[model samples]
Target: MITTNRPTGPVRAVEILLAGARMQVLLVRSHPLIPVVTVVQPVVFFLVVTARHPATADRADLLFAVLLTSLWGGTLWTAGGILRRDMADGTLGRNLVSASDPRLVVIGKCLGSCLLVLALLACTGGTIAVVTGIHVPLAALPWLVAGLVFVALSGTALGYLLSALFVLVRHPVQLTSALVFPVYILGGLLIPTSALPAPLAALARGISLYWAQRLLSSAVSGDGATLPALLVLGALTIAYFLVGNVFFVRVVHRARVKGTIDLG
Candidate 1:
């Protein structure tokens, strides 16, 4: 691990975040799977789905679903393993001792992952547009952009929370693989919550991606109240951050007590 002077206060936090972001960028460059999941998989899924439902090819709403699905997948596979990668690389203990707040590092990594995924989403969207001829109204472009930003934020928060939980698991790969489709179904990214049973529909309301999809749908359709979805999405993001911080604190405490950060 690289070493540097331990700065104090907010500057330290910012530095830690930048470091994590840089680390994430480096990881993405080295790891071929990040792009495969974030870009290739989504593009292929979009093409396959559209081909199966030829009538829905031009629908703007489907584009939003595909984009959100990509975001969730990228977050789950990339940002979700932040701490696990650190532990495996033998840097988690060093990071815990060196950083004032390790959560900031996770946040930074999530932010970096989201940014990269967003760029890949743009490429995916462009490719989908060229192939399917899907179009968004000029007026709706602003809302769509705002919706994308919120989607990234919501994904980042969820990634941070998941990372904290994943670090404690013995087999995080199985757990991570298990999470993908359930979140897709629950989040309404590819499925409509209205089509789900009453209990599942109600449960979908708790997932941040559900609100994100609602917000994106509203943005694409220019129907429904965007404010409510935006507010709920923001609230959920804050809640995830708070809950993730608590989880990180507990994980740190446990690691310290056990004299090792590698719980897995």
Candidate 2:
């Protein structure tokens, strides 16, 4: 009998996700600081913000809002970090040259980031709820989880996009933390994009995190425009993934043509 390859689709996707999940887990094990910061950073920031203002009694609740962005921040750096780490360790080029889809591999890595986000969210959310009495509606809990997952997918797409960009540059200053931090601030995670200057707010809407944060806020508060938020989040998630995929493909192709991937 002749050997044959199985068809790839959902099976492949699940496999990639599992692989990505494991990779994310291993990284957390290797570097314990990530989860610690994921759980602690927002609370710390919230404290600093509240100490000065003091009128935002609902600040704890608002601080909880940062979890989604925190998750994406983790995903952003982790996805790129994984790729860059692989490149540094001499595995990225080999994997890129392999027959398996590198996009899927990258997606899988992002899935790993999502797993960490889930854990951190649980710990941080639960702790804050117990300590501050601000809690998500029991009914709306599922929506919040869904919102986080969607945002993670979007962030992963962005991470993959940045990783591709990382290969194009030759120096650390050439990187885009400039845009990353601003996106985190303006993405309506740190503050409502509406609170930002109008022109800057409009620019922030270009990122999926804005919609994701809006959906999460609605889910947690059981108020606001849930339907519109969900619709926009879904659309933005798809757009981010597709755009990232195309960009990664093009960047990798260029790097290969230019013999630059090995330099990563």
- Model 2 per-residue lDDT tens digits across residues 28-104: 65566585557677677656656766776565446655666576666656666666677787887767777787787
| Residue 92, model 2, lDDT | 77
Global lDDT of each model? Answer: 0.79, 0.69
Model 1, range 182-239, lDDT digits (tens) per residue? Answer: 9888777677888898898888888888787778777767787777999999999999
Task: Give residue 243's error in model 2 in angstroms.
Answer: 2.1
Runs in model 2 with CA error above 4 Å?
2-8, 57-61, 172-176
How high a TM-score does candidate 1 get? Answer: 0.89
User: Where does candidate 1 stray beyond 4 Å?
Assistant: 1-12
| RMSD each, Å | 3.7, 2.6
For residue 83, give model 1's deviation from the true position in Å: 0.6
